[model samples]
Target: MSLDAPYIARAAKPGQFVQIRCNDSFEPLLRRPFSIHRVKGEGSRVKDIEILYEVVGKGTEILAGKKEGDFIDVLGPLGNGFILPRTTNHERRTTNSEPRAIIIAGGIGAAPLVYLAEELTKKKIKTIILIGAKTKNLILCEKDFKKATPEVYISTDDGTYGSQGFVSKLFHKILKTTESKFETIVYVCGPHGMLKCIVDICQERKFECHASLEEKMACGIGVCLGCAVKTKSGIKLACKDGPVFNASELIW
Candidate 1:
């Protein structure tokens, strides 16, 4: 079954995300959050939107098994994503040169990173991608990311492919080896534990970072209020206020 859902895409940003309900049944009571993936066209009418998700549990498995014609319910263009610093945003206002962007993905986290990379590339912004998985087979969208960024790095825990170490390790190594004194921004999407670790690293290194979070969701539009997360500011809904937030804003 072909899946199609029409949505307004006016608010989508590179790191923003959405929530989806794969089935009407309540067996899986919560909605699933997926990165905006990609938003096409402009204005009130969005030509297309894409989301890449891995089948992990009941909800996602149901989504994965869906045929081409199936229609899944989605509530979206939600959350605050990575906003380039005004200075940097202004510098790249007219030209794309000198905006250095780096993306890191773990497993299915590659989904949003791919979309983010694509957008950056369209703006003529230079990007680098670092993707990690336990093995090569688990690495998602290798070709897509490579196409978006001139430099792409791969790391596997088992040494089955690419660099044989943690993705974070490879990221640090790259930072060390590169001589380019450019302002760099980071966007990451992945498991909570992995994100926490990355956040720690970013804090220690003083790197500007943005992260897309995942949690149990229900309504996806904030009505359920099930995806609340504790932030430095206060309690906020992950499904509405975020699935994406600045690393500094998080209490982690």
Candidate 2:
């Protein structure tokens, strides 16, 4: 048996995420947000969508142990806009040139990055991915991302695999060393602290940045109002409004 959700695939976008209720009952009550990793099949007949997750606590631990056929309740394709450059309706400008993008993932954050990378490739945008984990085993989908982007960098805090440092450290180094201004957009997903640090760096360096946030969510939709983040505009629900937001807009 395989887990299935037909509606989600139709609605998902890069940088958006879903909230999944893993248990049969409401003991856990809240749904957990996971980045839409990738779409597995084609068209209206999509077989499944992949979601990358880490076993951090009760919710994710249960999800991690699920068998292939297991069914889980999920709500999503939630969030605000993705990082795609806005095209104005007034301007009928079209260009063959592809936009360049950089994706940074920390630990399980790589889950969403994988899906976003695939989407960027389909749009013919150039992509680069940098992922970090404690060790090589924790690094997910290195080969898959390599297929989507010409450049892929992996870093492990323990030096057991790729570069030996935090993922942000590698990102700063790349920003400093790269001669070509090939990077126009930056997307990041990770722990709150990590995300905050990256957002700060982007702000200081004047880079366009979007970040996926993690929070305790009671309802996957807007009904619960449990997962709220303070933004420049006001409070926004992470489930309905975003698991993703412009780095500058967040109060973090």
Candidate 3:
């Protein structure tokens, strides 16, 4: 998933994504969108970019077969990224005033949060990643998350992982019972059902939350309107206006 795309790496931001075509063939004409998994560099120079993916169908199966040194087609650093917290002028030397950002992901949806957490941690913002799956083997990105923050929590619907229920439940517990000196801000990305549940919980508690959405995107750019998602404001293109949006903006 790593590519030597310095241009993209330098411009890449947390929650920003790339669209990649599997091959030169016209069979699968459209490019697939993937979150920027990680970025590597120093100062303003970037060396590489990576993406996390799962093979769910034919297109992904083709993507999985890519070999090393293979020439791939990609379009990237697209869409708006997460808005990171900033330190106050008087306390600029200290990053303690930043909110404790909670990142929630389900199944393969964990793809985007890695870079998000990386960006947040770089700003000295406290982050806790909550990952959920149907089973232990289904859980993704725990080790990677650990590399970004030690506060990674997990759960599985079948009780085969760290917790024995939905990750949303665990988040509710943390929001209600856990004691933290900093404020809380929740970020989520997952299936519709899962998002509905989490948003419901956030609404009930009046917690601030943001969500990243995935939809069928034929054109990575704004044209075609293939991936329009209904939001509270109106119809917005997931590939253009978002992929990331406030929880209040989402209708569901």
The numbered model that scores best in TM-score is 3
Score candidate 2 by lDDT: 0.78
lDDT of all predictions: 0.76, 0.78, 0.84
Q: Against the hidden true structure, what lDDT does model 3 obtain? A: 0.84
- Over the stretch 228-251, how does candidate 2's per-residue lDDT look in tens digits? 899999999887778878888999
Q: How well is each residue in 1-252 modelled by candidate 1, as lDDT tens digits?
A: 122444535656777777787799987876777776766665666657778877778988898887766777877667776665324546554344355777889888877777688878877777789998989899888898888876999999899999998888988898888755556678888877778877777788777788888877767777877888888999888877877778888986
Reference-based TM-score, model 3: 0.93
lDDT of 3 by residue, 111-221 (tens): 888888888888888888899999999898899889889988899999988888998888877676666656567888888889889888878766677888888898878
Error of 1 at 213 (Å): 0.7
Which is superior by lDDT, 2 or 3?
Answer: 3
Worst 10 residues of 1 by lDDT: 1-10
Backbone clashes for every candidate come to: 6, 1, 0
TM-score of each: 0.86, 0.87, 0.93
Ranking by lDDT: 3, 2, 1
